[model samples]
Target chain A: MIEVKNLIKEFEGRVVLDDISANFQKGAVNMIIGKSGSGKSVFLKCLVGLIRPTSGEIRYGGRNFLAMKNREMKRLRRDMGMLFQGSALFDSKTVLENVMFPLDVFSRKNQRERRKRAEFCLERVNLLDAADLFPSEISGGMMKRVAIARAIALNPKYLFCDEPNSGLDPKTSQMIDELIQDITRDFNMTSLVVSHDMNSVMNIGDYILFLNEGIKEWEGSKEHIMDSDNDKLNDFVFASDLFKKIKEADAIITGNEANEENRKKLIQRMEEEAKDL
Target chain B: MTITGSLENIGEYALLMKRVLTPPDRMREFFREFFKEMYKLGVNSIWIVVIISFFIGAVIVMQIALNVASPLLPRFTVGAVSREIILLEFSSTIMCLILSGKVGSNVATEIGTMRITEQVDALEIMGINSANYLILPKITAFVAFMPVLVIFSMFLGLYGGYVICYLTGTPPVSTYVYGIQAFFRESFVWYSIIKSMIFGFIIASVAAYYGYSVRGGALDVGRASTDSVVINSILILMTDLVFTQLAMG
Candidate 1:
């Protein structure tokens, strides 16, 4: 589990992340969702130590992550895996070599053992045939899979993905989302994903933290997201026509009559739930 | 760039060098990358170095012979002038200037692209020292192979001069050979070698500093590559002047 307390990040006097606090549960797919420049990326970078927080405390599995020394941080980082939006595979290396790189750096295994482990990782990602191929030759979805394989190559205890499905088509995005969910559960690792894709949010966000203009606008599970009343979050989550219709249908099913007074009351109840949750 | 910006860049470059010189996390992998870089930086550069050095030698011989039209001057002076110029300056300094364009831009572009693509961040996430992993091998390769290239350049340069002298028959083969062998101080060779090694280090490290610190996207990578080549050339020339002053003052 990762716990963030009063996390604030500023850039040259401009606040990118306001005082926000949240917990990412272990063995679950936790998501940070926001619009462009809403501080989701900033929050993710801070969590991963890519960017230092202006002020905050980050505890990883009960240890003070922010106060750890460089060597201690590096030791912790070995158990952490990150997948970038672009997949971030070494273009010069083959898929097999990419997966085996972490092992080469950290593992005491011999050449044959490393090869076997790499092959196993590729097989796990259903990329066994692409083991010899370079990243440039693969499709975007395949590249994500290769990135996933490489991330799990060391059997990391934490997985962080930044916009895992950015350029992918809907079907591929859904597939990638499910893959992340499945891996999180199977490996029992804390998986934190930064994404704006509503499809991913609704599908795989076991826990979601929504930010708007650098502030925590809402926080809840996917099941409760639809019921959220925060106007900022509602504007974002129900911005689509399909979701707006769903909200109308849900209002009717819940026997609220879709009246102004009752609708306002429902939103009020949701706001309360947002605070309590 | 402003004075403050230049100073910041220098400070950052120094910090990057400090990180790069640290002991690598995995020696086996480091050596593997070192060997690969050796092939890329050294073996792949031989033909271009040879071709350029040969032409430079031939040109120096032809130009020197043209200028000394008076019969009062000995023809062997052409051989001596060409030999001194090629050994002391052309093979080390000029060859490095050429490589600053060739190898420096390549190193910068490669690392810059990786930076933009987030491959460097991925390495860091894996608990690897990205600077050491990405740069130390190239530095090692440059330091190891550049001297060999300079030596080869000197040999080919002398051969080119000999060919031109033989073809012109003005200095004659025996007189040119005698001139080349005359007053040959071993210290000049040492100076040339030291200069080449320093040039190689400057090219690799300066290019890498620009490349690894690049931000933004593909355009930034291109800009970094250009910056790397320009900066490397300026630094190499400056270092050449300083080394010459210090070594042969």
Candidate 2:
């Protein structure tokens, strides 16, 4: 479990995250969803220890992430897999080498073992054919897949992805989402993703935390989001054409029940007229 | 067991030192990035260095010829002039200028780009020392290769002078050779090598510092690259003058 407690991050006297607290459950997809500049990215950065909160504690499975020593942080980071927004693939290395890099740095495994592990991870991401290609040689979606492979090469217990579907087509975005969900389930790793894409939210967001103006306004599963009575969330949901149609359908069903008694009276009158004739 | 605040700096310093000692293999992964940088520094500036060297050699040769060819001047004056210009000033100073543009800017830009891309952060998250993985090999390679480059520059400058002298028809081959043999001292060559070594260290460190300290984005990387070369070039010229006074005194 990842728990962020009363986190406050201030930049140059301006508040980015003000007294924000949330718990991310283990072995599932936990998403931080917000509009642009709503502090989701800052929250993710804080979770990874990239940016330390001004006054807060982030506990990773009962270990204090904020107060740990450098080596301890490093040790904890070793169990973390981060997929950067740009894929951040070492542009000079091929897919195989990029995937192999973490193992080479942290593991005592020999070249052959590292290669095999890297290939396995590549296959898991369905990027085995692209093992020899460089980041530039592949498409954006492919690069993300490669990044996913590299992220899981270490068999990390925790995964962090920042905007995994940005700049990708809808189909590719769905595929990436599915991959992330499948990987989370298969590996039983705690996954925390920061994204604003609604498709991803509806598809894979097992637990969603909604932020409004640097404060977490709501937290619930995607299944209950339609029934959530929060006006701000309602405005956001109804702002879309698809959600507006769904809203119209729901209102019609509720209003039809109140008119059912009048319809029964009209039916009795019609039956009396038929008997007299 | 130390706190993150104090230990972060220590880790940064350690990574910096490690980078100065070991070049990361990821550099190969980013070879295209490196080469695009090298093309800007190495290939594009070839004409500039060549032009500067040509004029500098010609001017030095002219001044030496006028002073030494006088009937009252000693025959050894030719060798003395060649030795002084080649060993102390021309080879060391000009090469430093050339490389301040080439290697210095490269280090700054490369590391700066890495910072912008969050690649450095990625490395840190992976438990690898970003500085050691990125910086060490470059410093080692620069320190190791600079003297060789300096020697090549010295020979090229001398050849430039030969061309100038031959065109002017003022000093015969025999006179030039005799004068060079008479005045050229072994100590001068050793001093030139030592000066170049110092210059190389200064250039690499300054460039790496700017590169590593870069914040923001690609624009900042560009600024860092420019700032490093300017700062490094100034330091090189200042150190060159100081070393010359010290050596000659």
Which has the greatest lDDT? Answer: 1
Q: Write the per-residue lDDT of candidate 1 for residues B1-249, one digit (tens) a residue.
A: 999999999999999999999998888989999999989888889999999988888888888888976789777888888889999999999999999998999899999999999999999888888999999999999889998999999989988888988898867888888888888888888889989999999999999999999999889999999999999999999999898898888
> Can you write out model 1's per-residue Cα lDDT over A159-265, one digit (the tens) per residue?
99999999999999998999999999999999999998888998899999999999999999999898877889989998886787677657756765444555676
i-RMSD of all predictions: 0.6, 3.7
lDDT of 2 by residue, A1-277 (tens): 8988999999999999989888888889998888889998998998898898899899999999988998799899999999999888887688998999998777778889999999999999889999999988999999999999999999999999999999999999999999999999999999999998877988899999988778888899999887788987767656776676565556555557654553455456557989999
In order of the candidates, what TM-score does chain B achieve? 0.98, 0.77
Q: Best candidate, DockQ-wise?
A: 1
- Cα-based lDDT at residue B181, candidate 2: 69
Could you tell me the TM-score of candidate 1? 0.95
Q: What is candidate 2's local distance difference test score?
A: 0.80
Q: Which parts of model 1 have CA positions greater than 4 angstroms off?
A: A252-255, A259-277
DockQ, each predicted model: 0.77, 0.39
**Tens digit per residue, CA lDDT, model 2, B1-249:** 258854674576466665556544445434533454345444554565566666776677777887666888865465458757876777778778778888898789888888888888888778776776676555555665556666666666666667766787557655665666674578877788889888877777778878998999888999989988997888899998898889888
Superposed model 2: Cα runs more than 4 Å off: A249-277, B1-59, B66-69, B163-169
Quick one: best TM-score, which candidate? 1
